[model samples]
Target: MESIQPLIDKAHELIQRADQLQSKEPSVRSVPKLSKRIKAELNFLHTLQSGDVELKENQLQSTNLTHLEAVLSAAESLPGVSDIFSAKHATDEKGNQKTLVIDVIANHGAIWVKVTARRGHALYRVWQGEGDYGDKDIVEQALEYNNFASSNPVKFIVPKVHVMFLKGLPSEVKGELESVGIATHGHVLSNTDDHRIDVPCFDWSVLKELKVIHAGDPRRNRVNLDVSTMIAMTSNLTHNGCWFDYPECLLINDQAIEERHHPQLTALYDILKGKQLFACSTAITIYKDIVGNVAGPMEQARAKMLLTKVRIVDDCVSKRTQELGWSNKIKERPKIIFGTGDALEMVTVSANGSFIRSASKHNITYAVDLHQSRAFTERKEAQAVTIKKDDAFKRINLEQILRDLLNPS
Candidate 1:
């Protein structure tokens, strides 16, 4: 196998050049473009290094990065593979542009090899002349590549994501590819294990900052839990053997204050239904102030229907709480709970920095602003130290927050 270490070294040098160009003339628009290209090439170089291929400079076009990664991964796993060629479209005698039928060609002794990256489950339709692989059948395309090579070609189909080969590709499709003399490489995962590992879906590092923010002056610093963020946090808690104690009252945005048919109510109901995260609660308090303020008959009816639905759900969840093993946790008293009250009251109470008790005897913790806004590096009521919905979903640490909330000493 040929090594691309020298090319990887060259790519690093190009990155330095691009950086120098940007530093010398930051105002030049083309310098940023050059830097972007160099960055992409550097990523490609790192990908190829993972594949362990001896690559040539001719194989390094930015456009062919995906196809080349697939081919290199296949080459690294397959035996007796040597002298790989990156094929391009060639004109027929008619002078019309011809389609590039094969992405890569490899010589395994006297046999001609063609490699393709089967991106998704659409290959079956593509091969049968029914989809985007064009009007020509994939078998016919393989024959065309063979005709161009002037020899019969051995075909190899590798999945774009190596693990996808195991479950994503249907058995029928694998059989069809093999029936036509095209080898499907599903076992390439072992060779590319380092590259096939799953990446974290959420960034959890933000939790440390969130903990500090939430701990600040419990009254003034409030963390607002939006529907989706609440869902994620509750789901994480459930996974970690904890559950959210049903809130005293479900408080939504100021929109709910005006509109009886606000979508946030429906969203919260759906989250509760889907996850069954809130349990072991007697009943939810629908604030008379909020519900009684509905402007019209239709709005009143919607509010009534929502309350009815939530009550039914709560009753069902309360019954199953013991069976679900949340009874003990429920008895521990919910350290962190979510609800909304008058915005002015929340600000006033926080400003006073006083812990107040409700009729239910739950102590008031600091308030969190779940409304959409940028995070404040400096604590300011104007910036509000709010947790944006985007940041809550994108960044990590809800699990730790749950732990601290449940076991606060």
Candidate 2:
């Protein structure tokens, strides 16, 4: 703990004194020799100072690793966690390969975890470090691991720390992490005995009977079921009832009496005859054409039957609705509240990626685009584990999508 700087300074002073003495008394042969010795000793002192700084750094690194090991050990002891291993690496923004710790599978899926010994300002400093050194590495690694072929999907890469500030993680930090699909845990003081893994609660099995209809062409006049539609359908099904979304465009364009009947519309109406059907108020406008001399008797009969099943809803609070007004007073009087534009926008992104949006203010739990187009497929927000059209109907993908939709965090 003593000052090594004083010794280094003293050595430098001696070297200067010896150089001056040698210049003043050149004939005194030992003076030049003494200066050489002093210079050599100064260099040795400098080397010792360099080694001392390195020793302290190594000690700090060793302490960090010790804490990380403790965290990993605690994680392994948690119920349902197994096969814990490490030495996995990810590239930083500077292309430096940084090693992460503790890859494990706990109850659900594979998780790549990074353990941090830092707390409060230190932890935040590392997270906000230049060129994506801390949090970025974890995200990059988890994303890379997800790309590899594996049966168990990687849910998220977590940063587990032993301690945090009394108020807990800053909202900004938590928000940023969640935005990029990262999760966090372990803010308690370093106590392995009381540790618990915070797994997300979701009933993925509810989506087992989910039906996905994909239209090959984007321009095709197919049933476009949005997030509100999916939530209505799934919520009803969860409660032992059936519900469906019948868009106004589909119903108006596909009206037919006999052999030329649209198979999709016919099938949808047949499946949801006695069950609940959600449609925009515009759907009720078809009744005018049916009642007037424009429609045949068969069309009028079909329109009357469909009107009884459809529940008209105001999709948004836009001026367009105000301008058009409600077409049918009897049907659209008690309009069901659907959702806001922001909720729809969030669901739109979630539907494309099959990723959970936990920060959405609305109570939207699920969304579906039955006739998803190429635009949805091309979104950069789509996850690496995006369900392909072919696999969209698969039980596993359905379950995953449902879990994502229902995840509260």
Candidate 3:
């Protein structure tokens, strides 16, 4: 017992360090010397656990002659074999049921062990869009597995990337995992147990196509002639120079939106927000415009039903976010935005009528181009409305100004 004291102490230290490594999200490495020592201890533990008692047990247990020498060779080492096993994929008499089985060895008897896992359960099937389109890559941003890892003590993560969707199957989605050698490199969670996977599990490109379809509305009339009323409102709110906040909800630059030529995406968001949008009639007319300056004959005949009334949903910005506009986080054209009613429109369109309380934003999972979402580092030429020089006037609402400017008859 005294002789084995060092090994016991090393084992305890390794276990403690391993616990630390497994708890962090970024996977901090243990001190190099300690990591090496821990591996040695784990290996030694495996060897001792499979010592001589296993050797005799394995010899009497293995029936296959071909592996008899190999078993004996391993038995001679400090790490003696506990059992010898054979693996094969077997089918039933009718060849319908199939599974992999290995021989199990015990002091009393040997029995065939059924291998339960299959290619389907190996996790490769997940990214194949097996269940739904948009559903596959959409899960990338809001991955439950990654969130669970953040909560779990062990910090294990199912790879969020490197998964490919199989287009061949229409009803059920599948993966092209064989291209990455995931199928052939089975039987272990890690291809090599160096505490890291040689290949990255995520692919940014595969996650880009989150939505399958795009939609919008059409207009029946020529819309407004010129938006001077709105221009006055823009001047009223901007005070000639100020910044305001705006969310990325306005539909612009296409998440593959149809050649959307309606009101700028922000304008639509404002309509949903329930604040008065004060824009020039001429500008408002464009809100009714459709793609190609015209629609398909179906729409042409329906007289642009798709363009008449714009729809707003939760993706629309609300009062809390728009308050930044009042503060000029959105410095450019703040006045024009206020005149036309983009932010208030967003709240109205996206929220349930009775549900007006502000809550934490729901994390909608989707992959977006990082470059496209970059924040502006330097101030560009100001399209923003003028603001009062005093910071104390920041909370001033644009609505009263709009009523005064656009509606002054």
Candidate 4:
């Protein structure tokens, strides 16, 4: 393309020359420049063959990372088609449930997935996009058609998204998140004392107005508490700007509608009390587990809760055993896990009730606890037990918990 530079300059010169001669009829005076302009136009046309003037373009909107692969698998697995948009059912749940809502826009709207399928079953199915398919269109289809029993390979269509949350955000990983843009005070942490909030904090008042009420001597090395405050306030999910919580296995669903019998939106809201959407439904549970580091997959399956088996292979703690009792009516069966941190550290938890409930902080009370229980088997012995003295007891206990959860001897 650069090779055409001289030609382009000559074209510009000829265009000006032609303009000068326009008032007069074509004559010997204008012949040379007119010929040059025509030749320049011809050259410009030829350059198109090799591609010319690569226009400055922003990145094309890409698929949402979490759902793109799954949707592609569904599309290719079907008889025909390569791209699709659809929602897949979550494997963790039983019965007719919808796991994700995808909107694929390609090839004249190829296929629309109303429900996500798992283990030959389906759930939480809905249509997402320009059409108004009503509420239970897909759900009824799942019940009436029984796509599960069909021999035909069910095709799915899932769209992709380009936006994401701000937490766990990598520095080099670029994004256009507004809240992230607002909290451009401090980029790193220097002793978290500057920001006093929980591990996954969500407070943003300081940065909302982009003001600083507190004062400190100008210190380049000092932590920006205001920025820290905004980061803390960032929600698990955001609409436009303000962030909100995405409850367990759910997105930031709205429950404001009124319905007498089946408040479908409410039901969706109930399922996702404290969670948000990032990817498709196929791997939501897995994504949740890895990020929260709550517990292993097998643990979640066996215990019917997020469970960890922290081992006590190495020497551990004193001759003390404790039991924690926690209950929440909001749950049909509460989350459970076993981890390294004792009831004290609150870091390691069996069933990881903390992460599940805390994924998006809830006002409802949770009673999980650790209470010591004394026994009559106490002995007045000469030798002291070494398990109680080891500092690695936490690590050991975490291993034992996993073993117990996995092997369960």
Write the residue-wise lDDT of candidate 3 on 24-89 in tens digits: 312222223334545565555445455633323443222222122222222222111123232223
lDDT of 2 by residue, 147-201 (tens): 3312122211122211112212434455555565555543432322222333232
lDDT for 13 in candidate 4 is 55
Which order, best to worst by lDDT? 1, 2, 3, 4
Model 4, position 192, has a per-residue lDDT of 21
Residue-wise lDDT of candidate 4 within 297-354, one digit each (tens)?
3322432321221122211211111122343522212222121111111211112344
Q: Which scores higher on lDDT, 2 or 4?
A: 2
lDDT of 1 by residue, 1-409 (tens): 1445665666566556546644653542344444455567667777766767665555664344344344333333433333334343445787765645333333232233454444333444555456753443444555565455432221111111111142133355556556644444342322222233542222222211211112233333222232223322222121211112212222322222222222222233332222212211322332223335422343334334333322122222112222222233233122212223222112211111111222113312233222211110111122222232221122223333433332222
TM-score for each candidate, following the candidate numbering: 0.24, 0.25, 0.19, 0.14
lDDT of 2: 0.33
Q: Show where candidate 1 strays beyond 4 Å.
A: 1-64, 86-107, 128-138, 149-170, 187-409
The segments of candidate 4 whose C-alpha lies over 4 angstroms from its true place after superposition are 1-96, 101-384, 387-409
- lDDT, candidates in the order shown: 0.33, 0.33, 0.27, 0.26
Which candidate leads in TM-score?
Answer: 2
